[model samples]
Target: MHISAREREIINLLLDHPDGINVQEIAESLNVSSRTVQRELKGVESIASAHSLFLKKVLGVGMYIEGTPEQKNELQIAILKSGQEFTQKERQELILCSLLKEPESIKLSSLANDLHVTVATVSNDLNKVEEWLKDFDLNLIRKKGYGIALLGSERKKRKALGHLIAQQLNEYEFLSVVEDEYESKTRFSNGLLEIIKLEKLTMIGKMIRDIEQQLPYSLADSAFMTFTIHLSLAIERIIQGEVIQIDQEVLEELSISKEFIIASQIVIELEEVFQVNIPIAEKGYITMHLLGARQRQEKNDWQKESSTEMVVGSKKLINYVSKELEINFEEDQALFEGLITHIEPAIYRIQKKLDANNPLAGQIQEDYPAMFKIIQEGLSEAFPKIVFPTEEIAYLVLHFGSSQVIYDNSKEVRALVLCSSGIGSSKMLASRIKKEIKEITEIEVSSLANLRNIQIDQYDIILSTVEMPGFSKKYITVNPLLPKKEAEQIRDEIKRNSLTTEATLLRKLHNKKFKKQIKLKTPKLIKQNLEVIQQYTETVLHILNTFETISLPFIPTSSILLLEVCKQANVRGLIGDYFEVTNQLTEREKKGGLGIPGTSIALYHCRSEYVMQPVFLSFLLHEPMVVKAMDHSSIKINTLLLLLAPVDMQTGQLEVLSTISSTIIDDEESTRIFTSNNYTDIYSKLSYALYDNLQKRFKD
Candidate 1:
C-alpha cells in the first residue's frame, strides 16, 4: 500500500494520462534520465500490480492501464487490503471487474481476446468467480458464441462489488507507508516488510500515509529507518507509561537535518494530541519516519513541510545563536539546538577550549589569564576564582587536592593496591608501602573480588600480596609483612622502569678546544698595542659574556661567526652601535622582523697571545646601515679601520693612537671624544655606562 515519492509521481502521471506516458516523455518532463524514468516506472508497476491493478508495458512506448472510475477505485481499495490471500489470477480478476461494468456478462471469446488471454482461461476465471459468489444467487451463463455471463440483478451485483472494494480498501489503508522497497532499501534490507515488525513504525507509517500519502526524496531512506527504530522503542515505553533511557549515540548518529526537524515537530504535535511524554530521542525518530512516509506519498510535500513553521522555541533559539556567533542561520533551530542542548556536552566543549588555551594564558597576566578572559566574556557575570562546571571542578579537586606521591620528575602516578580481603591488615600494608615507597603517586586498596572488575589500564602499577591471574604482568608481588629489603628493591625497580627515553639518550660532547692558527709578519713586541686593543675589545667581550651560557641546542653557526667578529672589533665608545646591531639580529632571528641590519664594527686588534707578532684587526662597515641585511641582493663591505698592536707587553703598558684622516667625519660622539683634552675621561664614561647596563639587563 505504501508508495515511494518517485513511484507516486509516476502513478499520478499514469492516472492523469490514461493513454499512457512514455519513459522518454516522463524523463524529459521530470528532468531526469530516461533510465531513471524507466526504473521509477518499474517500481510503480510492481506496487500497482501488488495492489491488484494491472499495468501493461508497451515495448517501444511506455506503460498503460485502462480502467473506469469504479474499477480504478476498486483497484485502489484492493491494494490497501490485508492478508496474503489474494493470488495473481484473483488480482487480475479483481482488476477486470473494477475496469468493466458487466465483466461476467461479456462473451468469453471476446472478453478473453480483449484481456489478451485464452477463452479457456476466462472460462476457468468465471467458474472461480461463480463459486466465490455462490451465496449471492449468481450463476455463470454460457452462450453458444458469446462469453459466459453472471445472471444476477444489477443492483445486487453493484452492492456486492462495493462491499468487496470497501473490504480491500479498509485492509489496504492499514498497510505501513515505509513498507515499500524504495523507502526502506537504505534502512533495512527487506524494506518496509522488516520495519512493520516494530509496532510504532507500523503506526507512524499509517499516520503519515493518511496525512500525506508519501514521503520526500531528499530525506534518505536510512534516516527513515533510524527514526523508526528510535520511535518504536520510545513509543512502546510511552504507551506502558514508563520512562526510557534513550541512547545518546543514536541521537548523534541521526544528525539533525531539515526533514528531521520537521518530523520532530510533527511528533511533538502528535504527542500533544495523544497526551504522551515521549523522550527526545524517540521524538526524533518519529519525525524522520513521518517525513519519509510523507515524502513517499508526495515528493513536493517535503518542500512545503520544510517551509512551514514547526517549533517556535527552536527557531527563536537558532536566531539567537546566529546573532551571537555572527554566522548566518541556514538550518532549522531543532537541528542546531539538539547539538548543544545537553549541559554536559556544552560544558565539555568549554572545558576543552579552556585546557587548550591554559598554558599560554597561564603565563600571561598570571595563571589561566586567557581562559579567565574567555569565561568572563563568554559566560556572562558568573566569575569565580576557580570557575568550572560541577563535574569538571570535582575532577580538578580530586586530582589536585590530595597529598599524592610525586615522582623525581614531579609527575603524579595514580596506582592500585591489589590485596586479599583483610581490612586491618590491608590498611596497615598500604600505610607501610606508602612510607617505604617515597614516590607512590596514589594507592587504591581493594580486595580481589572488587579489583577483578576494575579497569587496570589507568593505574600506573599494582602492588599485591596475593597472586592474581591476568593481572600478574602489571602487578608487583610483595609480602604483607612489609619487609624493608623487599620494599627497597621494588622502589628501585619502579624508579628504573619509570626513566624516560629522553633521559637515557646520552649526548657525545667533545670538550678539548681547538686553537686557531695565526700567521704574523711583525717581529716587535705588540704587548702595549694589544693592551690598547683589549680596552676597546672590552665592549664586545662584555656583550658576549652577558650571554655566556645557552641551554637549548644548535645556536646558528652564522650567529657564532658574527659574535667572533664583534669580539675582535672591541672599539671604545662603540658599545651603543654594537648593542643596537645585536638586539636587531636577535629580534630578527626570533620573530622574523626587519632583518639584521647591514653593519660593521671597527676593531682595533691588539697583540697576539702566544706568538711574537704584530696584529692589526679591522672590520669594514657594511652600508645603508639601518637597512635589513637580509634584503640585499648581495652583501658588500668596502671601508675598513685597522688597529696596530704589539705582540707582547709588560705590566701597566698603554698604547694611544691619534686620528690621521684629512676628511673629518662629522661624528657627534667621536667629534666630542677627539676634541676633548682628556681621552681617558671620554672613554671611561662610555665604558662604565655600557658595562653597568649590560650587567643589570643582559646578565639577568
Candidate 2:
C-alpha cells in the first residue's frame, strides 16, 4: 500500500522506539495535530499487522510497536524494499539538480514526469526550492516559453552549484582513465558531464599543476579538487553564453595584480586547449581564486621583508585571536611570521573581489565555530578594508589551526594537589581545576599524610586543601570540591614562569557591570520589596515541585515530547493568561534547530507574549530523540532544556539565565541533572551548580 513519506517516517520512528508514544507527542514531532497522528496511526496499524507487527496503544500512555526483534527487522526490510513514494526532500534535490545542470528550462510536467509526481506536487516542490535559492541570492525564473530557469550572476550560480554539489557530490559518478590497472572510482552524472566534458575537467586539472609549477603556490588536496569543479562549472556557464561580471574598478585593480597576471596566462593556454574565447572578466574571477587559494609552506618567506602594513595587520589579528580564546600566542614568533605571510596575499584577495569559494567552509565552520567567529571579528578590525566572506575567513582559519601551541591542553606547570577529603572530593577538585585553569601538565591528588613520605623537589607547585608545614615548593590553598580562588593562583603562577610577564589587556573582559545596591527609605517600601522577592522565591519553589520534570519514557519525536512538556507548563501555571507556550515553541523551532553543535543537549527558549515570568524547565528522557539542532544537524537529544522568559524581560535578567544555562552545557556538574532520575537529586545538584556558576561569574 502507498504511504505518504511522513507516515513512513512515523512508522520508522515508532520502530526505533519500541516503547509506546502518545498521539500528542507524535503530532508534535510530525508538525501535525494530535487528530492527524491518530488518523495516521490507524492507517499505520493495519500496515504494521500485515507485516506481523502490532501498533499497541495504551489508554493513559501511548502507542508502541509489539513484535519480536526479528519480525521488526523484517518489517524494516519490507518498508525499504517497497518502492517508497517520492519524499518532498528527495524531490527538492532532483529539482535543484535539474535546474542547475540542465541547459534548458525545466517544464513543470517534465519535472513531474521524472519524479513520478503530479504537476501540483512539482509546483509545491519548486516553492520550497525558490525559498532555499533566495539564501544563495538566486531566483527561479518561470515564464510561458521558458518554463523555468535559475537566474543569477555566473559567480553566484557557480557558488550555488558548488554548495549543491558538495552536499550531493558523492551521488555523481566519477570516471578516471589513469594508466595501467588504477583509475579514479569517483563518478559524475551525464548532466554534469554536459556542463564540462570529462576531458575538459582533466585539462583544467593539468592547467592548475602547470600554474603551481610556475608560481610559488599550491592548493590543498581537498582545495584543488573543489577548485577543479568550480572552474569546470565556470567553463560550463561561459560556454552557455554567460560570463562573470566583475566591477570595472575591481577589474582594473586585479588586471595589474600578480594573481590576475597568472590568470591571464592560464586563460591563454585554456583558449588554445578548449578552442573557446574566454572573457577577461572570467580571467579576473580565476585570479581571485588563485589569490585566496592556500599557499604551499615549502616556500618559507617569513624571514623575507614584509611591508609594514602587512606585519602590523598580522600582529593585530593574532592579538585579537589570543585575547578572545584566552591563550597567549604573541611569544610564538613562528606563528606571528606565518600570519604575516598569509595576510599579505589575503589582503589583495579581499580588496579585489566579492566571492572566493572555500568548498570546505561548511566542515571548517562546524569544527572550529568558536575560532571562526573570533577570527571573523578579528579580521574586521585588522583589515578594516574589505568585508570578508565566511568562506574566505575559513581559509585563514587553516593557518591558526596548524599552530599547536595555541590550543595545547597540557599546562607547563607541574603540581600535586593534596586534600583532606577522600578521592571523591579530590577528583572533583581536579576536574574543576582542569575546567577553569586549562593548565597543569601533571596533577596527582593525594591525602596529606601520604605527602609526608613523598619528595617535595619533584613538583614545582603544590595545591593543598589543608596547611602543609615547611613545604619547599610554592604551596597554594584551594577548595577540595572546586578551587575558584586557586584558579587565579594557577594563572598568576603560570605567568611568573614566562620570560616576559606581560598580561593580556582583554583578560578582564569577562566582568559584568556591577549592580547598584537598593536601600529602602520607608518601612512600607521595604515591605513591598520583601513581598516581591518572597513571591518570586515561592514561584520558583512551586515550579520545581509542580513540574520537577518527567523523564521521557520513550524516544518520541521532538514535537510529541514538546506537547507533553507544554501540558505540564500549562497545568503548573507556567504559561501566562490566554497563552499556550507550545504554539510559540512550534513557531520558534521552524526558524532553526533548537540544539547547539558539538553538544548532545537541545535548548528551546523564547521571550513570548505567552510568558508571565521567566521560567526554566529541564526535561530528561530515557533515550535520545533524533532532533534537528541549531546547526541544521540531526542529533540525538537525551536532555531538553526549555527557557520561556517574560515578553519584556530586562536585558540583565535574561543574561543571568543565559549565563547559568551556558555553565550547565559547558561543565559536567550541572549536566548530570539532565540524566538524573531522582527529583531531590536533580534539584539539589542543579541549584548548587547554578550557585557555583554564579560565583565563578562574579570572580570573573
The estimated TM-scores of all candidates read 0.17, 0.46
The numbered model that scores best in TM-score is 2
lDDT by residue (46-115, candidate 2, tens digit) is 8889988888887434688898877777776666556667567767877887887665687888888878
- How much is the lDDT of residue 211 in candidate 1? 39
Task: Point to the candidate with the largest lDDT.
Answer: 2
For 1-700, candidate 1 gives per-residue lDDT tens digits of 5555466556656765677766656665555666777667667767766655778776424577665655555544443332223333443455336322444356666656654567676667766676666644555666786555666653344334333332221122223334542221112211122222434556665454343423334332323333333445445445655443335765665446555666566677658755787667555444434433332235334234332222233244345433432333424332333322222222433432211111122223232222223323333322222244432333221221121211223244455665443222233356566666766657666556566567554455667754443342335555443567667756765665453211111100011121111234243435544554555345334332321111122223445533544444334322234444444334333321122113221122222222122222233233312221222223322222232223333221211111111001213454343233233543453345444533553243
Candidate 2, overall lDDT? 0.64
For model 1, the superposed segments whose C-alpha errors exceed 4 Å read 1-59, 68-70, 79-237, 240-244, 247-268, 280-700
Error of 1 at 361 (Å): 52
